[model samples]
Structures are given as structure tokens and as C-alpha cells.
Target: PEKRKIISRFGAFHGSTIMGAALSGLPHMHKSFNLPPLPVIFAARPFHYLDGLPGEAEHDYATRLAQELEALILAEGPETIAAMIAEPVMGAGGVLVPPEGYFPKVQAVLRKYDILMLSDEVVCGFGRTGNWFGSQTFGMEPDMLSVAKGLSSGHLPIGGVIISDKVYQCVADEAHKVGVFGHGFTYSGHPVTAAVAAEAIRIYREIDLVSQARRLGDYLHAALADALNDHTLVGEVRGRGFIAGIQIVEDRATRRAFAPELRIGTDVERRCREHGVMIRNMGDVLAICPPYVIAPKEIDYMVDGIRAALDETAAEHLRTGQLA
Candidate 1:
């Protein structure tokens, strides 16, 4: 009998555990680590900003990705594949938002192959993606889900997996035969953490944070576009809701990245800090993930700092004769 394997994508981050690390596709997470325990396969990242082909429409790009997934499944023999996991909006991997119709098409392919779809909602969950969950925002119905980060609003460490009835039934049936579940966390049901998480959920519903995130997301997008869309060094500004990424490039027309040696992202982030704001960068992509309670003025302040930093960085590059 052949064992099944899990499929993930490049630039994707799952977690820091043994198996989760194996499932992650980011090299920094895997460098010198002996992992994957031999059953994880990586697929192409669904990042349109960097991966989309010139002259290709979003739908077309999504179709190509679906076809590639199907091809991979067949090559590996569908029976030998178990499930595919993905971040509805990839975080830690450049905040890549998938092209329209991407998840739905990928779901169809998985269904045809009898493969489960696992949604990694660690970053995109709890109002970050303008919804309670990214699955709903992007039109996907996952077989299983892993959620964290905002569950307890970071007051305490907690995460959980939600399984569909089918998966639950399988595990239950097997456990009945074995007379033991065979797995659990030491802090599985710590009362204090559970109580805090419960209150967090209650607050989320009471305050309607999801709706606020949606409204603010629209404002943030518009502000970012208005401020940076025409910037010569900004190749792309893309994201959803509270999560966003700004791609800095040497040449916007060609999307040519500044040489890694320049450390443009680090400098830009440092400059933003000097202006009283802080942003994280992965290579040349600057990330903006503000608190949910942030006000409109704060959003403007954040963007203003970023704009000033970009100008400063550009000036430095010119001074160093790295630009014309």
C-alpha cells in the first residue's frame, strides 16, 4: 500500500513545529534543518504580483495554476496524495494575494482527485482579511483549517485545528478501534487560556471588528494607491485588509529588484522607524500590518512615513550612483 503525501507551495509558512516546518516552503525556515520526514511536496506559489505572466489576465493565470496542480497530482498518482494546504492570503511570504478565481479552481482540482484542502489561516484569520476567515473571503470551503495569531488577540499563546465531519468521523472511527486518540498538547485545555480565548471571541462579535476591518481595508487600499502607485521605486502595493506588502524595485517598468547587497528594504524600514513608524520587510517587500483599532489618521501617518522613507532610499541610491 502506498502512503499519501501533503502538498504545499513555495513562499508559504505553516508553523514552527516539526511537521509544520517540513510543510513550509520558505528556505529560511528550512536552511540546515532535516525535515519534511519524507512526504511533503512543494508546488508553485500563487503569488500573482511576482509570478503572473505579462499580458496574461488574472483568470488566465489562475487557470494555468489549476492545470499545473492537476498535472502534479497525476504525476504523483492521485491516490498517493492526501491533502494540500495554503494561506488564502500568503503572509510571511510577501503577503501575496492570489489572483481572482484561484482558490475555487484549485479546490475543484482537489475534489476531482479526492484530496483534502487545508486552509492555513494563521495570519489571515480574525478580521485581518476583511472576514472572519480567509476561506469565506476568497470563496473556498476547506476540509480542515488551522487558525492562530488573533484567536486570543495575542494576549496568550493559543492555536487550534478545525476538522470537517468527514475527517472527524475517520479519526473517531480509527480511535475507537485503537481505544486511544494518540495525540494532544500538554496545554490542551488550560482553563485560563480557554477563558481568555472565549472572551476574545465574544469581543470580536460584540465590537463587530470584522466589519470595521472591511471598511478600513477599503480606506487603506485607496490611501496606499493614491500615495505610492505612481512612485518610481514602488513596483507594486498589494494586499487585503490589515495585511499588505509594498514591493520596492530598481526599475518599475521591468520589476527589476534592487540588488540584494543594497538592503533597500532594511534601509526603508529603518527610515520609517525614524519617522515614528515601524514596518517589516522580506527582501524588497515591505509589510504593513497595523493594529485593528488603528484610526484613519494613524493610517495616514503610517503611509506618510513610508513615502518619506522611500524618497530617502531613492535619494541614497542616486547618491551612490546605483540609479540614473
Candidate 2:
């Protein structure tokens, strides 16, 4: 049996289109369209903070998740599983970064089962992850890469897939026999978008965006830790490069979340907006992915805004007995 089913994760977010929705595991992404059965299966999310055992270490947690994936593949029948798609630093999935030794172990499993690794680099491509690509950042040697967003640096809409030489050779041979590739998009190679993407690449090269993101990301992460680590509502502050997530919780000891009805994440998002710093919330996890060119002082300002917003959220929720 040739592999057909693809594996995703529980908290993943691929896109908003029908195909993308089917590939995604986010609740909102799967809502109400009554999507038909697709070949996608979900594995455990690699969130150590929320899912880790009381005494489990990061490396062990990674191994456990990898084992779970292996079990999932076995149950599905390895030959019937084609590929597993992943985001190196899961973005819409609350910016969930993988655990230590995660990708290497997962890659080992995939190699053993002849399963291809498809990396979704839409959010972590370019300089966002401190390396040229998220795959590089996390030691993932994916067989394919899907890239967008940073490609044109938000200057234009463009995205593309990159396959390895082995896959490309197969595709080329098929195209030669069929006399065409038989796949395309309306704006597959729009001149304007291509030009913008090209120029964006040039700018990234000129400024050494990768190194900048790496250094600045370290500073940003430190600032966030210093500011929010002790906050009553913050359970964790996590991410890499310029991207980050601040997980808000009711009980830090138990890593408990605020009640859904409280909409704490939405409230934090609203407060951040009011403070003039934009952020999005996934349940109670507030995401902050600032521009790569941001300065230290600007980072301070952003962190301060979040601090003010969090403090206010804590005060109001406490007063109303909405949070403990």
C-alpha cells in the first residue's frame, strides 16, 4: 500500500482555505464548513509547558511525543502514510516551539518508515527564526518546504513549495512524460509580487536579517522573561527569534487556564491594542511577533505595554473574582 495519509498536529494552523482548513488542527479552522474527510491525521502537540508530566524533562517529553507519532504511524499502517507536515515553531498554535531533541527524533522515525517531512515555513521562514529557515533553526531536514508571508515581507502576496532533488526528479520525469507539470496558481508568478519578493530578499541580504533576528531575538526573549515571568497570570513566556507567546493562566502551580467564558486571552489582546501594541491571542496565549528591524528601545516599549496590559488584566479580573 502506497502512503496516502499525511500527519499534522493537534494545535497546528496551516491556512484558511478549504484544503488548508482540512490540513489544520485548530478548532476555529475546522469550524462549521463541514469539511469532508481528508487524508490528514493529527499527532500530539509538542507543547512541553502544558502537556509535560510533573517531573518530565524536555528531552524525555520530546521522546514521548516522538513515540506517540510512531504509534500513530503504526496504527495507521506506515505504508499508507505519505508525509507529516509541521511548522518548526508552530505559529497559530500559540507559537508553540518544539521540545529539545524533538525534530531529530521525529526525523529518525520518519526515515525509518519512509515518511517524508513537509515543513510549513510560512511564519518562520526568512529571518523570523534567527536562521534563513525554521528547518535550519530546529535541525529539521524536511523533504519539502512551504514558504510565504516573509517571502515578500508583507509587501506582496506570494508563497511557494520547495521540494528536494529526489522529489523534484520524480516530478520532472512525470512532467516530461505528461508534457506539463499540470499544476499552477493564478498568481503563481505575478511579476509585481515576484519583483517585491526579490527586492525583499535583497534587503534581507543587505541587512543580514538572519543575524539581526538572532541577536535581537535573544534580547527580546530576555526582556519578556524579565517582565512577564513573575506576572500572576503568566504561565510561560516562549518562542524564538522575533516571534513569541505569553501563556496566561489562573493557577501557575498547576498550569491551569482561565475559564473559557472569561476570554482572558481576548481581554489581553484588547488591552494590548489599547496600549498601542498589537498582539493576537490564542485562547489565553498572547502572541507577539514584532518586526525584525525593531530596536532594543522599541522592544522595551513593547514589553512595557504588555506589562501594563497584564497588570491591568490581573487587577480587574481579581476585583471581579473572574480569576484566582
Candidate 3:
């Protein structure tokens, strides 16, 4: 049997189904489940703010990450590797946006080694990154595309894969050989969910949601950057379109994160919720992904909420002598 390999990054959240959790790279999902099932390989996520060196151009960072992927394939034996998986803009992993040329370089390397490219666009599809798909934003032509979330804008539980012609044909042939496909959930293609998804896509086109997301995403990024970039506890603010993250640090000069035990990210997230704006906390990073239909005023409200939460958290820490 030809071996299959799925190269995922740390901090990804694909879902909690058995196979989904197994494919996940986040330790929290695997703590008690003993996941990964022996076929998945974790790779370095291209997080410029947290990992890219100062003075390195975005293109250089992308090229280096591609090289690292090539090395990993060789070490694992390219013949045994089947596929590489990724989110164009990492979501649960702190809204990490890839550096310039990242996807193209990775695609080139994967093509060279006969490995399949799988784009897990669960959080990035349907205009989240100002495009129909994040793969479009990053120049990735995946052999398999996984999508959910914004497909129906959370109106239904629907997710599925879009496979390239070659893979689809192979699976079809295998099914014929085996007498049946032998794979598919009872709700694989539920009629109600399909109708809702079709309606969602229709509305998105009628309203030009992609372009709107682009315009609004730009405004949102600028608002957050201007308001929070120089804050005392904000180590970095980075993202694209409607998704972004504000990384918190204990010492800005040293780029040291607060101790995990302190749970600064969780505290700030709680504060944002109290203000009626829900944000996600990934370790010491605070992430936000507002709906594409959000208004300019909503963007301001979101930023203000984050700023107020950060200020309140900082004051609390100072009072406790956690910061001097």
C-alpha cells in the first residue's frame, strides 16, 4: 500500500470528530485521546510575528519555511509521504498569516516530491480572507480542499472536501475495485444543509461579499494596529482581512510571553466577553474573526473592546505586582 502523510501545523483546530482530532496538532485535543494515529506529521507554521527573524524579508521567511518542508520530506522518505495539509491563514493557531511566497514555494516542493497538497480552509473559505478561498489568496492549487464554517455562515452543520480530478478518479476506481465506496456519513449530503449552503453562496455573490470583506478587512486591520500596536502588553498585532491576533507578552523588550499559569490571554478574552465582544484565546494570544458583514462602527467597537480589556488586565497585574 502507498503510504499517506498529512503535514499539519501546531495550533490548528479541524474539529473534534475522531479523525478530526487525530489530524489536529493542538495538544489540548490529544491530551487524553492519544491522537495522530501514526500517520500525521507536524510542521512549522509560518508565523512571522512570533518566529520570523528581524531584518528578514517576508519572501525570505517563506523560502526558508519551504526549505524546511523539503528537509522534512527527505527525512521521512518522499516515497512514503502522501500529502501535506495546511490552512492558508492559520486560525486557531493565533490567526497566523503566511509570509509572501509561502504557499507557492511549498507547492513547488510538494510537486517535486510527488506529494499531495491539502488545504484545510475550514476557517479561511467563503471570504474570510477577502477571497472566495484562502488558497486563492495564497496561490495554492490543492489536490484536496476541506471547507466549512463560513460556507453557510454557521447556518448549518456542513463541511466537505473538494478533490482534484485525479484524486477523485483514483478514489472512484478504488471504489469500483472494492465493490462500494465504503465511506460517507449519514449526513454526508443532507438536503436541508445543501439548500442553505446554496442560498448562502447566492447571497454572497449578490452582495459581493468577497470584495466587501477585503475592504472591511483592510479597515479592521488598520484600526487594530493604530489602536493597540504600542500598548504595554501587546507584543504584536498581526492578521489579514477580518481575522487577526494580538499577542501578549510579559516583557515587550525581551518578547517574553506571560507565564502559561497566569493565563493572561484567557483573562483578556473573559474581559472582552464581558464587554459583549467575544474573542478567542490561544495560549497568550487574543484572536478575533468577526463576520464579514460587520460595519465600520462595529470594527471600532471591537478594537475598543480589546483595548479596554487589555488596559483593565494590565492594571490588575500591576496592582498584584505582576508588573512594575
Candidate 4:
């Protein structure tokens, strides 16, 4: 088998185990263990809210990114490139959503080069993105789909890859040649976890959870937009379905981020926790990914909590000379 390159986006959080951490693009994970041993290539993440240039339309941004990908593959030699992995919504990477036409264009580039496309749906699968899978939401048809997180609704630890027929057949033939398949975790197919996942799938289908997530996601987005859009420190509000992010900045007009020493996101997160709400903060962005079972009232509460936290943090900043 020829060596293959695995291309990943910056700030992505695939996992924390050795190989998983290496695959992750966030520097925090690498601080403890220098990683990405040899095969991984880092690429720019398509976060429209933060990285899209001024006056650039979403479609153009996507096109430019796709072209950049093609250039990278050519430079690295496509034959050596094994796969390009991505999250349809870029979850732990601050809920970074791709610009319009981004996934489709990237998929086209991958196909042109015959490189495998791996959709890492760990955080965007199973109704989190208003669809059964983020690939459906983003129009990506991948060779392999890695799913986790909502697979069991956080009820159990389980993850697996859905390999396409072509890849499956190749692996099968290769295994026969080698007399062993040779790749599996100790708990790769644990029955208990599978049973929990089975039940979770049943509930999602029985209740039409995908549609519900879509509906509630709309409510969540509107509520957050209404509450935080005008805040002085909010740079942008972006996300899909139940997963969303409010990017905090020192200058909202210029989208200038606050100093790292300020730790504004941390303060906001602490305040949200004080208000009985949990939110994940990445740099200056505050992310909210509530459970699918939450009701409209709970949605209101979540928004209110975020609002209160932001307001309080802003007030504190003003008092301390951190904000003008």
C-alpha cells in the first residue's frame, strides 16, 4: 500500500488519544504531546464568520478555499494523499460553519484527485444539525463517515466509521491477502454500547428528532441573535441547528479580538455557569450545544443565561478599564 497524507483543518478537535490528538489541529492538545507524527497536513478551516474576508460573498469564499485545496494536493502529490477529513460544521473548533458551497466544492476537489473524503461527524451527527447527519446538511457524500457524540446522546461511549462499499471491499480483499483484518479497538463493537445506540436511534426516529432539532434550532438561533446581536463585545453569531457560537471581540465593528490575557471568553463562561447554564468557550467564542430533548422554555432559559453572562462580563470589563 502506498503512503497517504491526511489533511485536517486548523483548530479541529478530532480527539485526545495519541493518534486522535495528533489528528486534532488545536495547539492546546499538542502542548502536552508534540504530535501529527508524519502523515497529517494542516489546512485552513472555512469559518465564514471569522475568516471570510470583508465584502466576500459566501460562495466566493467557498470557491477560493476549494482552489486552495486543489493547489495543496498538487503540491503534495495527490497519489500520496490518502484522505481529507473534515467536520461538516467544525464543532469543537468553535462551531465553525463552512461558507456556502464549501463542502460540495471541496468534495469535487477530493474526487478529482481520487483522495478519500472522511466526514468526522463526532459532534454534528444524529440530529444535532437539524438532519440525521451533517453530510446531508452540508451536501457532502464522503467515502468514510466517522460518527460519535450524539450516537448514544452522550448516554454511552461509542464511535465507529461507516465505510463505503468500495473501501469496504478493498479492506476485505486486503485482509484476505494478509490473513487478518488487524484494525479494531478492544471495545470496537461492545454490545451494551450498541444497544444504547440502538435505543437512541429508536427514540430519534419515534419522535422525529431530526425535524425537532431543526425546529428548535431555528428558535435557538433567533433567540441568540435577538439577545446578543447588539452586544458591544459580540463580533459575530454563527452556527447551525442546536450548535451555535457567539464570537466575542474587543471591537465588534472591526472584529478585533480581545487580548489573550483578558480571557474574556473564560469570564463569560464562568458567568454562564454561575447562572446555571453550561457553555464551552474557545478563545473568544462562546458555544452552545444543548440537548435535543430540551423544550422551548429551556431554549429561552439558555439564551437568557447567555445574555446575562455577557452583560455582566461587559459591565465588569468596563469597570476594570478593560473596555472603553
The models' CA-based lDDT, in order, is: 0.90, 0.92, 0.87, 0.89
Ten contiguous residues with the weakest lDDT in model 1 = 29-38
Q: Report the C-alpha lDDT of model 3 over 229-258, residue by residue, as the tens digit.
A: 889999888887778888899899878888
For model 2 the local lDDT of residue 313 reads: 91
Cα RMSD, each candidate: 1.1, 1.0, 1.5, 1.2
Displacement of the residue 112 alpha carbon in candidate 3, Å: 0.6
Q: In model 4, which regions exceed 4 Å deviation?
A: none
State the TM-score for model 3.
0.95
- lDDT (10s digit) by residue, model 4, range 1-324: 464689998988888788778778998888877565668888889977778889999999999999999999899988899998899888778888889999999999998888888999998999888889999999999999998878898999998889999999999999999999999888988999999999999998999998899999999999988998899989889889878988999997787899999999999999999999998998788988988889999989989998999999999999999896
Q: Write the per-residue lDDT of candidate 2 for residues 131-249, one digit (tens) a residue.
A: 99999989999999999999999988899999999989989999999999999988889999999999999999999999999999999999999999999999999998889999999
| Regions of model 3 farther than 4 Å from truth | none
**Per the 3 Å backbone cut-off, how many clashing residue pairs does candidate 2 have?**
0
lDDT of 3: 0.87
How does each model score on TM-score?
0.98, 0.98, 0.95, 0.97
